[model samples]
Target chain A: MRQRLMEATVDCLVELGWSGTTTTLVSRRAGVSRGAQLHHFPSKQALVVAAVEHLSDRRRDEMRRSAAHLPEEGRTRGVLEILAAQFVSPVFFAALELWVAARTDAELREAVAPLERRIGRETHAYAVELLGIDESQGDNRQLVQATLDLVRGLGLAASLSDDARRRSAVLDSWAAVLDHELEMP
Target chain B: MRQRLMEATVDCLVELGWSGTTTTLVSRRAGVSRGAQLHHFPSKQALVVAAVEHLSDRRRDEMRRSAAHLPEEGRTRGVLEILAAQFVSPVFFAALELWVAARTDAELREAVAPLERRIGRETHAYAVELLGIDESQGDNRQLVQATLDLVRGLGLAASLSDDARRRSAVLDSWAAVLDHELEMP
Candidate 1:
């Protein structure tokens, strides 16, 4: 029941946005009773924040599982593709809605700030591990960080419109750049 | 009166999220009568959309003027810094609010889509002009686009926290990478 409600909250966020999403709507979509929903989440902010955190954890675990199956050749390009896809997913959109809404809502900001920080640290660490990057070397850490930023921006652009072709081109170009930078002695 | 109202609309957007911003609030902020505010923009969507387009024009012109004053040496780094600053500005935050709002609001999506496309085109053109890149060369165009995406992502990161030091480090690293890439034959 908790998982169902949280999934519905993310769905509301992605389809209805932060403003349009309501607890009643989420309860109906989740097929959970209003009393049950209120029992679990007292407020909309609490519900949505918990939903995003829940989804993010699931997505991270999924990504780690998928990483184990990556093909041997062209691994860098494959990893870039995976990262780019994650940004364009519904969970990312749900999180974006919260991020923008949190900018003005003090309560939401307080709830979201720490979650965002933890997600950032964990994602960066995961990327470093996936690429086998030696951050002690010159600029390696920054380059990996830049790649994440680039994909995020591309994801934002994708949210506005279907720019998959252009996104693919940019990702391919970035993968080449990353491969070369990492190869440096 | 129009300029004042539009500026006030953006102020409301940054200070208030899309759901919180209203035409009444804008009129109060602009010190304009309800009659005058409605005379210019009939609805909140029209008012906010026009406000973003209006401010974007002003910002672009300001950027063009500033470009002329960039120091001769280290021009690439200077240009990167300028680009990064634009993403962190209040105007960008205003635009971001609309972008997220538009994702779920069909009417707003219609209004914001064209303006966003125009801004994307103009910003890309300006970046190319400032960087003096030869697009005929391999991957130069994609590299420029990636740089814009990188800064945008960094801007999003800044929106959450005061990551200025980390942002500066990323920009410096990108400038060096961009310089090396462009130097290739």
Candidate 2:
């Protein structure tokens, strides 16, 4: 029941954002009674935060599963393409919505703060593993981190406008540069 | 009067976010009565939208001035630092608060949509100029754009956690690779 409600919460958040993800709507989407919803999450903040954390975990797993089968040819490009898509996808946008909301909502921010830290740390480890990089090497680690940052920034742009051409251009150039560097060293 | 109100509006946004940025608070901060605030901006939507656009223009001008004097040595790093700073500053945070608020508020989104489009276009052009890159070259343009994307992503991370060390590491790695690439051709 909690899992179902959490999934519904994410769906509501991605489609409706913060304001629209009301308990009523989430209950309806999750097919739970209002009473049941309250029992699981007393406030909207708790519900939304749980949903974001849930989405991140699910996404991390999905990436790991997808990454294992990447094609040998153009592997760098392949990794970048997958990572970029994830960065701009609806779930990431949903998380972005929360991040933005938490900026001004102190209570919500408190709820989200620790979860975000844990998620970020886990994400870095997951990314390092996914990229098959030597995490001990500062340059290698930074390159992967930079790739994530670049993709995230491009994803934010894509959210606002028709920035596909520009986004791809960035990915291509960065991938080329990263490929060259990793190959050299 | 309008300028004062807009400044207060941005202050409220950075500190209080959307839900907390009441017109009354903005008017009080601006040292104007409610009537004057409404006289300048008929509604909260009008007020917040105007403030964000105003901030964008002001920040744009600031970037232009700062960009003109970038040091010759490690020019790319310097440009990226300035830009990354801008992306995480109060004005950017204010704009981010608006972006998140607009996700759930259709009326607010309508007001912000065109302005966001204009701001983004101007930002791209300004970034090109700041980096002293030829606009005609696709590779050069993409590299500049990529830099913006990376910084924006890092800025987003900075907003959430103690990301300074990671952000600089990414910047250093990307700068090295970019320097090598640009120098080669």
Candidate 3:
């Protein structure tokens, strides 16, 4: 029931944004009574933060799974496609709502800050494992992080419009560049 | 007076986020009456959209000025610094507020879509000019676009925390890589 509510909260954020998401609405979407929601998560911030944290875990898991399944041939492009898919997911949209909302809300920022840090660390670790790169190599690590930033920014742009062709081009260009920079397999 | 109101709107967004930006507050900050504010923008959507477009123009002009005045010998690092500064500016945060709000608000998205498109085009053009890269070179252009994506994504991360040291390192690393890929001047 608690997990169900968290998932529903993320859904509400993706569909209604920060302003439109309410504890009452989340309860309705979760098919639970307001009493049940309050019993588990007393406040809207608590619920939303919980939802974001849950999402981060799920997203991290999904990335790991995708990375594991990527075939050797053209795996770089495969990796880019996986990252691109994450950017377009509802979970990304939900997290974006928190990022924007947290900018001005100190309490929300406090709650979200650690979660983002954890997610960032997990993402980099998995990316290194996925690409078969050595994280101990300083320059390679930096380049890997750069690839992440590029894919994330492209994802943000894609949310506004269909930039698939251009995005893919940029991704392929970046993959070639990364191959030389990190000495990737 | 009109400019003041728009500037105030951007200020409010940076300091207060989207929900807290109201016409009354904008007028108060702009030192104008409510009537004056309405007379200029007529609605909050109009005011926010106009402020974003205005910000885009100013940022482009700043990028141009920075490019023209870049000192030789270490111009590469200087250029990255300028881009980084722009990404962390109040204007970027203000525009980010609109982007998140527009995720669920179709009316706001419709108003912002064209302004965002124009800003994106101008940003790419200035980035090319600033880097002294030949856009006719297909590989060079793709890398330039990728650089923009990297910078924007870094900006997004910096907004969450003070990652100045790491960000500068990434900037330097990417600049060296770009010198190899795009043949930067």
Candidate 4:
């Protein structure tokens, strides 16, 4: 029931933005009574918070699934492709919308902070694994963090633009980030 | 007087979103009489539209100024740096809130379309001049478009994470896009 409610939240988010989302609306969308919603979520804010956690868990699982096929020899390229696909996928747009909505609401921020930390940890860990680099190495760890950030930014840009060629270049450039020779400004 | 009104509109946006923006609020914030606001701009929508235009013009002018100082050899890098800086800057966040508000409102979209087109044109033109690549040329021109989109995404991510190092890598990777060997998998 909680999972169903969380899934319904994404459906509602796609249809109605943060301001438009209400407990009654969500209950109707979920085909559950108002009392049931209150029983499960306690409040509308609580519902959205659970939805955020749901989305984060989904992304983490998806990332791991995609990365499983990466060959050790071409791990860097493979990991980049997996990460790129995960971020740029159409399904993730709802999560992105929720994240954008979180900026204005303190309760949403509280819900999102842990998710962000988990994502950062997973992304950094993936990067270190792909690069075969030690995170304990000073600049190297920073490089991993920085590269993860770059991919996130590039992914967001690719999703928003109408230009296809530009989007492709962003993906390619992202793949190249793992190569040391590509680091020169 | 017009500038003062636009400044007030921006302030109003930072505090209140689309539903909250009104003639009364703008007049109050600007310390101008409703009569005076009517004298300069007849409607709240018109005032908001004009503010959008003002911001677009200001951004274009700033981009030009920043690019003008670039040494010939570093022109491409400098142009992108200026463009990326515009994203990470605090003023841009207020502008961003307005952009999101505009997304769901038809009047706002109609008003802001010209600004979006002009920015695309200017960015493409600057890329052509600075990179010495014709806009009509092959993927070379596409590379420029991609870099611009990437920067926009990077900027959005930076807003949430406050990670400057990641933002810099985004810009750096964009600079490296020219050298990437893109082949469709």
Give the TM-score ranking, best first: 1, 3, 2, 4
- Candidate 4: stretches off by over 4 Å: A68-81, A88-91, A127-165, A173-185, B18-20, B35-49, B71-80, B102-114, B127-139, B169-185
Off by over 4 Å in 3: none
Per-residue lDDT value at B38 in model 1: 86
Q: Positional deviation of A77 in candidate 1, in angstroms? A: 1.0
Q: Give me the runs in candidate 2 sitting further than 4 Å from their true place.
A: A183-185, B183-185
Fraction of true contacts retained by every candidate, in order, equals 0.73, 0.75, 0.71, 0.19
Q: Residue by residue across A1-185, what tens digits does model 1's lDDT show? A: 99999999999999999988999999999999999999989999999999999999999999988899888788988899888888999999999999888888888899999999998888888888888777779899899889888888988888889788889888888888888777444
TM-score: which is higher, 1 or 4?
1
Residue pairs in candidate 3 whose N, alpha carbon or C atoms collide under 3 angstroms: none
TM-score of 2: 0.92
lDDT per residue (tens digit) for residues B1-185 in model 2: 88899899999988877777899999999999998778778988888888988888888788778887889898878877777878888888888878777766777777877887787678778766666667665467677778778887887777765567777777777778767765332
After superposition, the stretches of candidate 1 with alpha carbons farther than 4 Å from their true spots are: A183-185, B183-185
Best by lDDT: 1
Scanning candidate 4 chain A in windows of ten residues, the lowest lDDT window is A176-185
Which candidate, 1 or 3, has the higher TM-score? Answer: 1
lDDT of 3 by residue, A33-127 (tens): 99988988999999998998888788878777767788888887787788767777888889888877887898889998988888788777777
Question: Candidate 4, which CAPRI tier?
Answer: acceptable
The chain B TM-scores of all candidates, as shown, are: 0.96, 0.90, 0.94, 0.80
Quote the positional error of residue A152 for candidate 2 in Å: 1.6
lDDT of 4 by residue, B65-98 (tens): 7677788664555666887887775445555665
* Model 1 lDDT tens row, B1-185: 89899899889888987888999989998999999888878999999999999999999898989999998788899999889888998899999999988988888899999999999899999998899877768899899889999988988878777689889888888888888787444
The true-versus-predicted C-alpha distance at residue A21 of model 1, in Å, is 1.1
